[model samples]
Target: MAIFTIDDVEKTFKSGDVSEKILKGVDLALNEGEITALVGPSGSGKSTILTIAAGLQKATGGQVLFEGKDMTQMSQEEIRKIRSSEFGFVFQSSHLVPFLTVEDQLLLMLDVAETKLNKKQQKQEVSKVLDLVGMSHRKDAYPSSLSGGEKQRVAIARAIIHQPKMLFADEPTASLDSKRSKEVMEIIRNLTKTLKITTLMVTHDEEMLPYADRIVMMKDGLIE
Candidate 1:
């Protein structure tokens, strides 16, 4: 089943008297337990579409349906709640707290999501996710001390710490070297499949395509 659907989605930006349409009535769906890669050139609106679907920005028109609910119609507070509880994000940068240890990062995510787990349970959950991402050995290390690949692993662990139903990744491997990028992609693929989380990722790297179950190409603001 499709866990997320984007129908006739549009986005536009205006500056002074000039206006630009970034997304023009694009449509796509992300199925359960699969990774869908959105690939396009610099101006193709792939990242715009990902952000819109993640509720980070509002679409100019059309529906973003998650589990049969229209995200576009949700109030700001409603969307915020969903973003915290149901959606996970991994950006090109790891974006980890400079001072927080690897283990603390996942704990922070659970706190932000207001997860129901008690203190002890939360720690166990964090450990489990860290193990899943193969970063458990570095749980006590700070982000500053981690390698590029290790930091990305920690970031992925934090993103899934709460078991979100959907994961949105924007150029997740852009900063890493080719080998690290492959490792990161492999982790994402294995976790999404094992945890049955639907994933929509925006990436310009053609090397990442093989890891995705399906690839959606966009051009000139529309899927092509």
Candidate 2:
């Protein structure tokens, strides 16, 4: 079933006298436990739609429904709560805290998500997620000491540590080479499927498209 829906969504940017419409009546659905990839040329609004659905940005018009809740109608606090607790995100950059170890990073996410697990339970959860991303051994390593791929793996582990209901990934493998990119994609697919987390990703890599369960193409701000 569709846990998330975008209905006639529109986004526009205005600069003084100039106005540009980025998304024109976009309608899409993200189903339960599936990965959906949004693909389009630059400026086609794929990333805009992803952020809108993720609650990182607002739609100029129409509804962004999460589990049937109209997010566009929600207050900022309400939207922020959902984004922090129920959603996960992975970006092109690992974006890890330079000072934190792999395990500490996951712990920080739990703190941010307001997870109710005790310290021991949180540590166990961190270990499990690290193992999921094949980063268990590097749990004590800081970001600076890790390779690019390892850092990204740690980022993935941190993203899912709180067991978020939805995952939003934007060009998650763009910083890696072909081998590392494939590895990262496989980890993302396997983790989301195994944990039954719904995912929406915006990616330009054709090689990564095969990992997504559905591919939605966009042109001129509309799904094609």
Clashing pairs in 1: none
How well is each residue in 53-138 modelled by candidate 2, as lDDT tens digits? 99988999999999999999999999889988999989989999999999999999999999999999999999889889999999
All candidates: TM-score: 0.98, 0.98
What C-alpha lDDT do the candidate models reach, one value each?
Answer: 0.94, 0.94
Model 2 residue 171 distance off true place after TM-score fit, in angstroms: 0.3
The digit string of per-residue lDDT tens for model 1 on 60-94 reads 99999999999999999999999999999999999
Model 2's lDDT to the true fold?
0.94
Error of 1 at 63 (Å): 0.9
